[model samples]
Target: MLQQETRDMDGHYEFVTVSDEATIAFRRYGTPGKPRLLLIHSLALDGSIWTDVISGLQGQAEILCIDCRGHGWSSRAPLSYAIERYADDAAEVLDKVGWDQVVVAGCSMGGCIAQAFAVRYPKRVSAMILIDTTAWYGEKAPQEWRARAQKARAEGLASMAAFQATRWFGDRFRAENPRKIQEMMEIFVRNDLDAYEATCIMLGDADLRSALSGFHFPVSVIVGEEDYATPIESARQLAKAIPGASLTILPGARHLTPIECSDVIAEAIAKMIEAAAH
Candidate 1:
């Protein structure tokens, strides 16, 4: 049986497990009868990042916040990392829970997984909420930045944390939320280098642009007002490409908009779910 634990963060806890030998740690909130919403964490940080969002959505929706493989309590995979593997793992977890369909809300890396999941298992998804993520690089990234992925895999987490944090947050957010930013940075900075590198490689190589064109579901793109990584322009392009997709911009936020602007995200999600239900 899967072990359950508790924490005081709006009545959540650290629940970790190695399902089929894969490290799977996540938190569950709200009544089971509500529509299930799977919350996928960003790269580096664990599932705990969704605490604020989950707390607000509790009772309104059933929340399953997950830590992807090679992050949080989930153990590493034997082979190389790819976005598809994360999607497969997510599908398996949902299978275990007996959910036929769910609303997948993802951030950054998790957003990538959400795209792949909808492509691979269309029937399993009711809708998708992609926050600060893109299907693929709009233009080719710098060679050195691309090559750094391998270095991170070889050198480990300590060296790559700073670069990761810089890309994920803006200067304003760094100044305003120093302590919270530091805590999140540690999650990435202190991660196991190999796992982090593998995930980075996965993000670098995976392309979901083509996949989004043919996807037949409701997709809501949430962009941070000042997100440098996946800026408002990128989010607009994604929304435009996906037929009937909606877009929202969260003010005073960066790449971590779901966490930084949980109230707004929750409102967007609630509206999307309601629209779909009607």
Candidate 2:
């Protein structure tokens, strides 16, 4: 049996074993029997990234926050860690929880997994919110990602902390919210190297540009104006490719828009949920 635990203060935490070698940790929040929303976090981070957004969305929807394999409290196993694999894992979680359909939202690498999920299981997703992510990495992405994987395997996650801080947050946010930035850095540093490397491989190899047209559901794309990792151009391409998709750009924000601009992201998701009701 899966080990399941719940707390009123911290929501519900459970570990579901997906395979002999892999177990995933996830949390559930909000009222049951409400509209469901699935929130996926970016690479090297966990479901906790959605803390602020969750607070803003309280009582409006039943939210599921998953700690992807090898991140957060989820198990780490030696596996391909392909984007498709991540999507499958997410589906497995839904199956375990008996959720048939949901409004899906993902940030950065999480966005890639969301695309893969929507492509593989179109009927399961009623709508999608893509945040600070791209459907396809450029041709050189594989090599760059491979190098990153190698570096992480050798140097561990600490070596990348400074680079990630600069890449994920704008200068102003870092300057203004030093404590929050430090908290995020701690999350990044805690990632297991093997899992981190596998995720990097997945990002390098996965391309969903051609798959975007298959989505007939409503889609929303959000990006930070100063996001260098997956810039506004990437979000624009997503909006253009996904028919009838809407785009929102947060001024002066960076890659981690969900954290930096939580209120906006929460408001956007609320609007999306409201629109889906009709």
Top candidate when judged by TM-score against the true structure: 2
The digit string of per-residue lDDT tens for model 1 on 73-178 reads: 7776564466777888788777666777888899987888999999899888888899998887554643433677667667776776677667777677677778
RMSD values, in order shown:
4.1, 3.7
Q: With candidate 2 superimposed using the best TM-score fit, by how many Å does residue 84's alpha carbon deviate from the native?
A: 1.3
Candidate 1, residue 116: Cα displacement in angstroms equals 0.2
Give me the displacement of residue 117 in model 1, in angstroms: 0.3
Candidate 2 lDDT over 57-120, as tens digits, reads 8778888999998899888857658788789889999999999999999999999999999999
Query: Relative to the true structure, how large is the alpha-carbon lDDT of every model?
Result: 0.77, 0.89
Relative to the unseen true structure, what is the Cα RMSD of model 1?
4.1
lDDT of 1 at 162: 73
Taking all chains together, each candidate's TM-score versus the true structure is: 0.87, 0.95
